[model samples]
Target: MNYERQPYRRCGRSGLKLPAISLGLWFHFGQERTLHDQRAIIAKALELGITHLDLADRYGPPLGAAEEAFGTIYRKDLRGLRDEIVVSTKGGNPMWDGPYGAGNSRKHLLATLDRSLKRLGLDHVDIYYLHRDDQETPLEEQVATLDHIVRQGKALYVGVSNFTPERTAEAASLLRELGTPLTVHQPQYSLLRRRIEDGLLAVLEEHGVGCVVYSPLAQGLLTDRYLDGIPAGSRAAGGRFLTASDVKPEVVAFVRTLHDLAAERGQSVAQLALAWALRDPRVTSLLVGASSPEQLEGNVAAVDRLGFTDDELAFIDRTAKEAGVLA
Candidate 1:
């Protein structure tokens, strides 16, 4: 395995050291891509030093397919190498039809994790996340469920995704009281999505919880693909997760300028966006999704040049403001 491609960072105060770029099974780990393709991408990632595999119970198009398929890959390709991997999956995101199917109740969280384990063909996962915050459920119960999962030996550590700074801090305190400790936080972070800059990063830093950031490419917007215009057969063209309406003229202009900055730095536009996200020392790792091995290789290369000049950061900030995406 080419494990020296990227550096590893400790996940907060934990002993776990995650690769600078981790692979996410959030996309194409299901029927949208063939099992051969999924296995190949995963193999390539592992070969390139990406040991963290991020997933969710509701990730696949038919739900649970992602985990089920990864189980097959694990047994076939990685059973003996499990010790080298940091496998993670999420629950509490509506995997079934019952009222408990979606909430963070103890029943839902525990049941979902059991199913996730069964599908991944593992007795335990390194990290398990509450995929979302359920306001309808009591926060105490939700936090307690995470603590229970860790105590039950289902997860080595616990985390939450898409949670606000206040909720994250509260959960951290509760988990600390329970002796499990919130290990990491997965947030949507990129040059285009600056919501976490408000307080979440600070909260994680304060609580000593590592940040595993996802969508560092901003759903393909921070790439050179949109620098000229939205090409056909692109994410924006599909009008699915990324709408064409989301791409304004100013956004395109900003991307073009960002592309030039990336060229000057000997990286792709996506690399610049990713490196920019990693500039904050508080960020532990980035959860990057790839459709192919080539894409994964390119994203991994971003680690080669993660530092930025003061002037470059200032330019990015000014462009983001001019593009009206600072939010």
Candidate 2:
């Protein structure tokens, strides 16, 4: 936790400044881990100057466990330091089986935020986001409801995730008209996943909505732990999210080339990938998850040496194209 953090950037045109590397509690901060273990990671993150903590209502295996976990961390380690941290949580994802349990409807969005606030033991979160797009619900209703939440003092800022560029633009406009602009867009952007490159990046840039990309390592594919094959105690081998079949021979070979490139730069593949995503000034922060504090520290190390030479960029393009990651 002795790493030095570079300068932080503003989220869009907002006055809020976020750390270059933010910690996300989406995957690991759950009921499965002990409260002491969870608090330890938060403590480690704060000690390392990671000031942002991202959570959601449905982040737990049993639902709402992650926020409650945060409540425990807040009381134990973050009580007096709340003002120094930026807490973000999302709703609009199904947490219960009933009809009122999901979607971007005002009813669901408003009620869910109240519940999320209660769970986190906070009056209002720094930033609130829609977990996903609800095609069945009208876009205007969602945007208006989010703006209303800002007015009601439930959320300071609003954002959207997993939204298409067209829908993102529309939502931004709606929020803009109300004078409560959309602060950021949380998209799943990584070397392995280039879907965001298909106009989403431009849309956010044009609208002045900053991006906080998740899964920059593609759920561990870009890491050295998967180059030889799916090793024990890895995400792919867990048979839960990323699977062995997803790690084809071509993918492994591609990872090897990327790993070589990272070595040439005196960095890990994880570090290289994280640095690559942050190269865009439009990216406000890279939201990363870690099962252990060691992993968290290792991931943030990429922020130190992010200057890639022209030749390195060319090498990256060639290697990524061959792996079908740049196409």
Candidate 3:
């Protein structure tokens, strides 16, 4: 791996540095895909300096299948590169039928972390995140459990995902007291979804926590694929997180405008969206997932044109607002 080609950013106050774009295994890496296909994607990612692979217990058609798939690849191809890679997995999402199968309880967090490590065939993960907030559980209890995980050497750092600014502040303070400071915040952020800009970014900066954002392309909404209506086999056509209703006539028109803007910049709409996501200094990394090596290469190209003028930023903001996709 040519480390010099892949730029790394410091993760907030932590000494660790992550690639500008990290590969996410949240989708398209399950039983439906063969090991050979998964291997190619992973191999391409590492070759491109994307060493941070993000996973969660709740990912995959069947919960935990993604981890198992990655485990197979790790045992066969990535074991030797373990020290050079950053493997992050999250718990606190529903993985089973019972109450203990989900949420931020000590029992659930510890139990899921153990299962994840077993699935990945790893003694420890680089970072373990509490997937979401559990209002029913005490904040102290959740933070303490993460503290315990780090203390036990099961996870090197801790993070929170899908948490509000207020909860993030509380968790950071608690973790600081526990001597395992929060390393990062994983939120849904992109040009189309700018909710983090309201207050989340400020909170993270105040506490010196890095931001690793997901859905930086708004699940392909910011891409050119949706300009001609939801194509077959697209996420919107699948009616999962994205839907036909999401691609209203007006939204399609807005996407066309964004496409034109991207063309003016001599890049694809996807590349422009990714560059926009990384434009934030507070963002430590952008989590991107790909189904093919070609797609992965297209995404990595965004790094080549990350800079944007003040006028371009203002134009994006104005266009996003008119498109009604401003988070």
TM-score of each: 0.98, 0.96, 0.98
The worst-scoring run of ten residues by lDDT in candidate 2 lies at: 1-10
CA error at residue 116 for candidate 2, angstroms: 1.1
Write the candidate numbers in order of decreasing TM-score.
3, 1, 2
Give model 2's TM-score versus the native structure.
Answer: 0.96
Count of clashes in candidate 3: 0
Model 1 lDDT tens row, 1-327:
677889999989888899999999976788788999999999999899999999999988789989998999999999998899999999998878868888899988898899999999999999999988999989989999988888888899899999999999999999899888999999999887889999998999899999999999988888887766779988899887898898888788888889999999999998988899889989999999888999999999999999999999999998889778766
Model 3 residue 155 lDDT? 95
Question: Local error of candidate 1 at 77, Å?
Answer: 0.3
Give the Cα error of residue 17 in candidate 1, in Å. 1.0
lDDT by residue (tens digit), candidate 3, 1-327: 657655799999999899999999987888878889999999999889998999999888688889999999999999899999999999999888798988899999999999999999999999899899999999999999999999999999999999999999999999999899999999999876788988999999999999999999888887888887678999888898888898877667777887888899899989998998898889999999999988988998889899999998898778767767665
RMSD of each: 1.0, 1.6, 1.0
